[model samples]
Target: MNTLLKSQLWRGLLLAICLPGVAMAASIQALNYSSREVDYIAVENPGNTNSGGGGDSIRPYGQGGSICCFTVPEKWHADLKVVVVYQLSPDPTFHRETVSVPQYPDGKAGDIWLIVYEDGSVGAVVSLYGPSRPEWPGKIKGYPVPTKEYRDERRKQKLKREKASLLTVERGLLLRGNSLPDEKVKEIQEIIEFQKKVIQSLEGNP
Candidate 1:
């Protein structure tokens, strides 16, 4: 082969090996907890005080509580900033417990409507709702009734409830300082890109 062609081939081979290492550096492995282990996950918002009526069988709280923890890769910890996003409903009448992220070591917990770490890089969105309460004739016994005068108050409330019932979408990322790493962020970028395409395709958007 010609010298210039050989040199180009060598460069391509080197890049192929180095690229995977760069992608692996910023990746995180998330561990979804069972009902028996203790782990710590960070929270975003601090004052959101809602006890989501105990926790359901599917959703557990605290140590031995149902939670998902991310075991961050060691190399990225020092150089990367992790961000968590918590998405919660803005409605005021929901009877569920306040959403929160438990602090590490201290095991302390607090209400955070949504937690965003590293700005918008990485985070988990949580849904907080209460179980249905019993009903009575004059007024639904335990649940509070709306006093708003709007003609479609019930319709508006129904819309809000449906919105609140949505699964909170949480995204996580390992970014360099506050900015996304140029070439280094490719792996995650590809995942995000693919998701965007999938969503657009599903929505029939061009």
Candidate 2:
């Protein structure tokens, strides 16, 4: 091949190799700002498998981790929209809302976030920052204020988890205590007593 023709062919090959990488993939994540827990949340777009992602057990005012492998074009289009399907805790029925893909800042796409609002409405935003960061693009600021009932529920859950952890530790101590010397076994027993008292306190006993 001629020198100029060979150079042109190599340039074309390099562009082809880099073009796919320019279409970057963004992770799909769910942020729940509502009082209710989200049992599940999913993003769907017709005929676009790369736009499909979902997550489950997203707590109120918390993020449910990211589902990967979704892409958003650098340029915005009028027809770009996605369907957000979600189910709240204790609700067997699922609900869906159609939301437009908001423009990414600087005309570049980042992670896609599906935000569940306090009034059960869903919103979409694309940003490199998460909800915990100040630069988060979601309209809801900070987190959902913890209601009394929510606080109580979290406290109960914490108590249950701590009690279970203490029980496991106590079991391990008992297993090792049998092999220890008399003084060591006595110390272990004292520790066990303290753990029991803590458990009792967690259970609201006087």
Candidate 3:
């Protein structure tokens, strides 16, 4: 090997031996905007594996699990499929929400936002986030999604809902033709656009 290659090889070997978990390490945080403090959590390790157990980089939780820097390294620009689980504030019941987010520009190293309730329960919102605010949305209440398995199920159900919605709107538009009011047509148009986006997103995975 050339000098640079040899040097890199040694560095990898050293990290593997001396600091095994550094490569697998991921950080979890609970955001408390009102209090103005970020709370960090220690997470369990289950050795990092590449997505799909193959060349694909996105790891599916299958049922459920933790993701960190070991799996998605810092500076990674791709979006991730993740579930945020928490209890609805004051309800004492658990909820799960699925989201896709890449690492954020302002994010700290290894930081994964843990959904928290305003009253201090864990993840509660079941909303998909856009790229702009990669961090978890705080304190939104929704129905309970108990496990990663349930979260995955919910995700599938959502896609189905979108597909059905798109078909309905298209059929309605065709039937009504030019007779529909502008306001009514505009509302359906927005829903059609949103459903198309959701369906297109689902096509990328399973």
Candidate 4:
């Protein structure tokens, strides 16, 4: 190993050791293999907090996928615990568990992964979300996203929802004979044409 690589590994290990409640971060295995700090990703379950304290709870933004991510922009100094409640199951109350990751100083751009599993245990998830994320594009990073093949389907679904909403408003306007401002009328016309094109594209019509 090179001097720089060894130095970073030691730093990561020392941080883990100093952290009071890190669950299972023995050696900084991922850090040792990383070319940069962003490449060093760690995951550990920190146990559940039924009251939902310690960190941010990020639910789905109603766009796509079945995952949640919580991040603290300041720095990675301590373990951030998240409570994952599984609401769908035969049992009345589902499992509630927590997971966490060692702190990443803001410059390192580190991220903590949280997964709500079927068994009701929310723990440290891995980085299998892939390379490109067009859904959120830039805001969301180092997180799980649907595959490119599925992105088109998601986009289509979003467009359909928007189209339905527009039609509902336009119907109301028609019944009331309301005179919408000129700009509003133009915007709605553009949206109608856009939806028609999207539907045709999805059907492989051209």
Candidate 5:
């Protein structure tokens, strides 16, 4: 074979051997959030002061039940769809809300925002308060609701009891100022764009 043809053949063989390894590395770098089942008490009229009957008129909302929860590690991103079913006479109402929470800006690590939708249209954005927050909106008064103090105390006690269980897979890797590789970050942004497209498709928005 001519020298030029031999060089070309060698280049092709090298690329064939390296391409699969590159693809496998890319797959390993991708982050995924584990779906967890959590029970949260859905309160109707979150603005209601009284914890009336669990229905729609006064304190209309069901008690705690299992719902899928997604926990995204820092420097990663996740799109979660939370569905809540309201049981009422005539017909039951099913509400599906999608939230895209990106774990950037390390200070907002614990911040959670709820995107409410009505008939596939954006309704409101509700910020979920974590254990350090003073108060949560729509909190029923005169009721023995779990307070932030209670949660913090329980979390500390649990951590003390089960130190091994407190270690997350990405614990030390998610420290402040920690960042994913530039290529991985760009890939994550593309995933976010894809999730946005999915949301728009679900809402029937062109």
Candidate 6:
């Protein structure tokens, strides 16, 4: 190893050894790697009054804002784990899981991340660096990347939103009756036609 690398290793070891009783506080954040949308992710940090974390909803391949005040030991323990409660959208129910924290290569402290993987498996990780950085220690590398299923699900959501908007517009036009100008009426008709075609195309998609 080079001079800087060796220095960092020694520093990490020293902190873990010298600060055995020290506790490091880190904020909790959610990273979604699954195709489904995730929301209401609550982490139960035992003995901490601010244990309720993860209210932000994270889209597929996205990260939610961090919640404050969870503490971790200066030194890693074999049984370190967190209790995560979350809900996947359209499911109408919440899930509770106990996720074990992955080992950090350097015994340094950082923020806690609750990850929802592609296969629906969940895990927790601590990193001084973000997943995009090389220093991040985890089985998975890099931030969440969109999958084919995720793209399809997004398209379906867009179609639903558009259809709802179209219904509102149609209702408005009906209420206005012939009071709408001829040119304005024609423009609205053209837009409705275009939207219909778009909706049809999306609905037909597998």
Query: What is the Cα root-mean-square deviation between model 6 and the actual structure?
Result: 9.4
* Residue-by-residue lDDT tens digits, candidate 2, 10-77: 78755553465355566787778778889988887755646567655688877777687455655666
In model 3, which residue pairs have backbone atoms overlapping below 3 Å? 86-122, 86-123, 115-123
TM-score of each: 0.17, 0.61, 0.28, 0.34, 0.20, 0.67
lDDT tens readout by residue for model 3, 1-206: 79999999978865663353343333343333221121232222223222211111111211112333323333433544455444332345444445555444444334454443334433312123411354533333332224556456667988888898899889989899599899998998888898898899886655
Instruction: Residues 1-206, candidate 1: write the lDDT tens digits.
Output: 99999999978755653453242111111222222211233332224333111121211111213333222222222233234322222322222223322232122111121221222222322212211222111111222222334325444554454443321211445424237665646766665566555544434421
Candidate 6 residue-wise lDDT, 32-54, digit = tens = 88878886676776445365565
Point out where model 1 deviates above 4 Å: 1-20, 25-74, 89-206
lDDT of each candidate versus the true structure: 0.30, 0.74, 0.45, 0.40, 0.31, 0.79
Most accurate candidate by TM-score: 6
Which regions of candidate 5 are displaced past 4 Å?
A: 1-69, 76-91, 102-108, 111-206
TM-score of 5: 0.20
| TM-score quality measure for candidate 4 | 0.34
Q: Please identify which of the two predictions, 1 or 4, would achieve the higher lDDT against the true structure.
A: 4
Query: Per-residue error at 193 for model 6, in Å?
Result: 7.6
| lDDT (C-alpha) at residue 163 in model 6 | 100
Ranking by lDDT: 6, 2, 3, 4, 5, 1
Q: Is candidate 4 or candidate 5 better by lDDT?
A: 4
Instruction: Kindly report which residue stretches of model 4 are placed more than 4 angstroms away from their true locations once superposed.
Output: 1-53, 60-121, 125-143, 147-159, 169-187, 198-206
**Candidate 4 per-residue lDDT over residues 50-114, each given as its tens digit:** 32312222222211122223323233445545444433223344445455543332223323344
Q: Of the pair 3 and 6, which is ahead by lDDT? A: 6
